[model samples]
Target: MSERSERIIKHSNTFLLPDLGEGLTEAEIVRWLVKVGDVVAVDTPIAEVETAKSIVELPSPYAGVIEELHGEPGTTVPVGSPLLTVADPAGAAYRAEERAGSGNVLVGYGTVESTGSGRRRKPRVSGVSGVSENVSVARVPLVISPLVRRLARDGGVDLHELTGSGPDGLIVRRDVEHAIAFRAQPASEVRPSEVRPSAIQPSAVPATAGQPAVAGVEARTGLHELRRTPMSGFRKAVVATLTRSRAEIPEATTWVDVDATALVELRASLRTATDPGPGLLALMARFVVAGLLKYPELNGYVDTGREELVQYDGVNLGLAAQTGRGLVAPAIGNAHTLTTRGLDAEIRRLTASARDGRLTQQELTFGTFTLNNYGSFGVDGSAAIINHPQVAILGVGRIIDRPWVVDGEIAVRKLTQLSLVFDHRVCDGGTAAAFLRFVADAFENPATAFADL
Candidate 1:
């Protein structure tokens, strides 16, 4: 077929809303960044779309003047529905010729033709979309992925001048570190301090002569018109999840003190011998998993709808990581099967991914249990709420030297408090207490607990 014939047959380019989560078929258009007659380039952010998973920015695929915006903000469009149309009649024909010759299309620049009008018959309208014009908007120009952009915004890092080191010179976590390191260097070797004139004193003007007669008090206008922008996709998702968890789960908490001296000593000894030893957090995670194996009821979920306590055979431990956008719980799959070193490696990887906003849907979902390490923040204790459906969450406190009784004598020992929160509907107070006790015991004598398991 002639290239001109392909061009003539090609119709308008249809931009569809991609699936944002586990087959999430629809999403609400949060806002449009461009208007009709505005020129858009491929990969330029055209609109903000909110899905059940998160709020995401949709980029344009075809470079042209925006022909039309198919839906307004707050309207939910199906996954394959036309979000907007770009004037790309000639580009469409070129795509067909390339596809026929090479059997492959260019990335992020090709168009997917629609079968019909590609508009949903019924659009959903639940939440408000769009930003107020009064808000102070800052334009950040950074060559980074959407995930990296989200991460940088949350971390309060300026991305304008940072050099990227990823594929195609894209910005990544390491690039951020490099920027921080570069800025931390001293400006010069011998910097002179500014010396102020201590002896010189200025003559004060007489109160009556220096003060000019005040005219009628001038009125000043204040920034009284406040504008509130709707939450971003990620922020909205976090709120929805936390709200659902609080509403559906009947959570209860219990706290216990553990002598963590043994665990600490073990970690120090192991680090001296091993090149890269298991960190304290990883060692504790292993002990926690072992404890879960002994107390299987704690490694289960409460299905309130069906009135069933669903016990999981595999243990996937979710680590609650604080990210720039919000809290994210990314799972270490089959944590029970991993050794102390293995668990540590996986936990580090997962947490880094969570902070970078690179976690997959599966990693963020289906966690059998959760671990919140408040100790990282030097907290002694906190009662964390159980993540919805999951029966239990474990919180770790900071370890400190304290007075304790040993052989009927006062002695100094390293102690840390452990908090266990569970769904009261699925497990009782006694079970929660016993489970924490078991964890404490395993940490005190990890060799005995992990010897055969």
Candidate 2:
């Protein structure tokens, strides 16, 4: 369990959406496991959400019937906004007279005091989701936030005249903004001052009203326009990181061809029906560890603040994993200390977590060097971008049967390409070439590579 779990065990009137990762401000609702009126236990997963980093299961905070769901699936919700509301009899009663919020501004797991006594609200009108059919049309919805109240007051919008569209009929800033917009528009249409017995509209302003309508394709005066999508989430993050990598580091690339026939056979010989043993990647990783140990200059970082190129005492092997969601590099700490089988298991664990979008922040950070196996994509070779802060990244390409000279005789051999991208600030071509040649030599002679170990 995380250290925050101790404080997060408290029940609350509403589940405040959490910052999913690395200051992620928002997440899209993928699916909801429960609806209004559904009874849920504490920590029960109520929704599956996709943040900028990963897909997460949002758990319920209070054990009671769900009073409301703040947003529908496919909706993007901001962190700190209400996720859902639950009717916790015991917990709500404890804070009934206390309106003070938790001191933790960014995040909290404390209970919230509801309006009036701690009485259970009737299940909302079915089919309408979170709306109650019996709620008075003329009555003003509860205004909870001081910010929203002040915004409405300054805008000359009467809260009592408008019904809220938020969960459990809570008035939000967006609601006030909409009311202000409606009033500002020419009063030709039925003044949207109150809920007009019609279904409440979310913040979705019609394209013609606030902005030009472009349904995937944009309208231009002259040429044809293709689709346009707002760049968000993982793809957005990738662009930012890659852009920084290109801007900050002075990088260089080096490549070499190797005969991996011996390495393949050695791995096959170690496999059995009961235990398949480590894979070629793991063997390559062991070779990398050995190479880094010999060429320690490549296993280091460049600290621009100190204007220093610092070498690390140990190697943290970062395995670059490509998932459908995005590319994530999860590091194996102190990888040089692990044996072949142990390295394989760590690689598998990080790979699974990356694919499943369950990788923690710790798993995704702190690396001295990286191994990028682009061979899985069936590509011959690629000069990859170095993961920032780390000075080097090694890429492995696909192994294919190719003609090679063997002991002065031309023969077919399993050939693979070894590519290295290194920060020029840390080391020159000589050091990079040495590291590449070392790995290639290991692949060429696996028995000699593992002889000492």
Candidate 3:
């Protein structure tokens, strides 16, 4: 916050979810880090929400007691909506503390101070003062409580579709609870073959935001009928990114079977002499970085609108890691400056964070190049989609025993396939092929290729 904006004083304040950047308009609450009545400090992470890009932890803007939470986990919320309320008795001190936050800018982003620094909000009446004593709240309408909304979401009921029976036609918990019971009643009739146990029924979960049930339509003849898991925000973003990459970039794949016997032997020799050095992927990463330096054109993106190639000063190497959650690629900043061991440690750390679902927004994006080791999946060669905006992606396949002719004699050697997928707009086939060749040569002769390191 700026100096002028941080001087405002008030007993209570409402925090609204801020724009998370990258044009993402909504996010689903993954978990709550803080609860009501908890005393929190400025910039304290209050909740974790999964956006289209990554999972982010929202920091609180005020130091005070948490008055209320505005939503529950698994519920998607739009930006600029109330996230929570905080009550601070010493508003002046809290306002001062707000100015001293970590450099990471997040919630309570925009600050515009009104004329009066001591402005307060109008309080609502605690009791009915002008109405009949026996009036029922069922007559109300609109502006329902967060708890009521959460109940409706859990029960797979759409509050907007039902007519509120509360005072002023306001929807309450009871209304949503009744709707759940109403839907819980089975259909008038059911065939033994069509009906499965309730545990396997996909209808329990809503297909869309408001409509309940992922309707199981029986096709006349096909084997596609089964339960379904709707693509989450993460999964959907993966689809959109891959789809856009395929549509926009004209990509080509080329692969070569490389004798990795020398690379394996190099690592084995290192393990005996020094602290078991970085993994093979780290050695491959070192080679990739060196290759990019030799062939810089393959390390950039093409700006279609401006008609130019945008080259980066340093490499942010993205590691494509697969976890139980889904696919995620967290970048290692300034990979060009790191040693093989340093790169290995960084990769391990990011992989742990990715698996734990704790990777921040920065770690999940902004990569100049990507290295995908699909070998761990026991697959050989892949014509992968270019992680959009990146000119190329290199994939490594499983290393296994294979026959090779060494100086006219047949020999058994450990071999692996190296595949490269590159955007045609940035460079031609010659440049792309050279880059892959450089990497493959490094793998075949690790001693000579990595001698400089």
Candidate 4:
């Protein structure tokens, strides 16, 4: 051992998880990059975590040998929980010191001060009565003991409205029992004005809120075991986004079937054995870019807080890729200025990166409009959900052979379906129809469309 290691008494230092932004509360640990015995530098990436927004690699703040890893892979960890322990020979002062943002590791992140003991302790609860000595009045109910907190939770007591009877306004078990008993009284015994509004209502409490499972119901249904999966991480985020979209936006869908024989032939004529020119999705994306330029209302997001339609001068085209994690939409910035081949390259790159979980925050979150080519799954058509707060999304279905009219005669031709889902707040049905028709006309007559390009 080195001279500095010989002087240290024990390893009491620990590193806590930092706050990842965007209103996220917890993250799932995807994997750990370092093992327990590995030495790490101040900026070494130690673990990869999957947040609601994206996958992020967390860096170490202290230079030391790793002592312990707290959570296992695939486990969801809260924001302030211990990530790992590090033993440094620099003594207690260095271990207790906090690491503020250095503009590189993470913005608005800092280390939590260690309590100078090897054993972990319960984090101090703020906004409590006796706990906050600097403040004159407590803003929330205060209970220091875990037993008292559990009593309030299990009894369905609203601690926020309760006035503590203990010294310095500390809440005790007696106060919780009183609230629980008061709620149990008959309705005729309680007056309207005497009833206090609880932060947690009895009916709103969860089935597993410090309570046992409903035993008889499962037995009656003949169910022996229940497999439960928590609604969290990326899946939960996607649900929240779609829920908000449905609740807020007045959306409408318009679709059209087109004879794409000309568009298919155009690609075939441009390709050699070695070079495939541009893909069908890329050609469709180029046309969509042109359509958005004509119908700018479709290429923007709603500023709900300002109650304004914030349209952009350029398009950030998002391509939705299905990965193991879920469907992720990564956008190409300023896509309007790119050529057909450039769009093809970007779409491929983003699709690969998204599938590998290597997409950056900016790529995943900056789309003004989205394009989902669900035809890769060999489907004909779908009414896709609009990726909010963007006003519109365009989907391309599988191209197949079909009978169509040409020169007033029926003939076999290549055909495809196009669908557009748009926010009615931005444009009327006429505008959305016109935009969809523009793309459909381009697909039917690519030579005419390429002349403009």
Candidate closest to the true structure, highest TM-score: 3
The order of the candidates by lDDT, greatest first, is 4, 3, 2, 1
Estimate, for each residue in 5-60, the C-alpha lDDT of model 3 and write its tens digit.
Answer: 44343467898989999888888888789865568989999999888878888999
* TM-score, every prediction: 0.60, 0.69, 0.72, 0.69
Q: Report lDDT (CA) for all predictions.
A: 0.67, 0.74, 0.75, 0.75
Q: Report the lDDT tens digits of candidate 2 across residue range 330-394.
A: 88999999999999999999888888788776777777899999999999999899888788899
Runs of candidate 1 with Cα error greater than 4 angstroms are 1-11, 23-229, 272-274
Worst 10 residues of 3 by lDDT: 103-112
Task: Give one digit per residue, the lDDT tens place, for model 1 in 85-108.
Answer: 776746544545434533322122
Error of 2 at 302 (Å): 1.6
Better of 3 and 4 by TM-score: 3
Q: Which candidate gets the maximum lDDT versus the true structure?
A: 4
Give the TM-score (vs. native) of candidate 1: 0.60
Ranking by TM-score: 3, 4, 2, 1
Q: Give per-model CA RMSD.
A: 15.6, 10.2, 10.6, 14.0
> For model 4, how does the per-residue alpha-carbon lDDT over 234-324 read when each residue is reduced to its tens digit?
8888998899999999999999998999999988887999898888888889999999999999998888899898889999999988998
The number of residue pairs in model 4 that clash at the backbone is 0
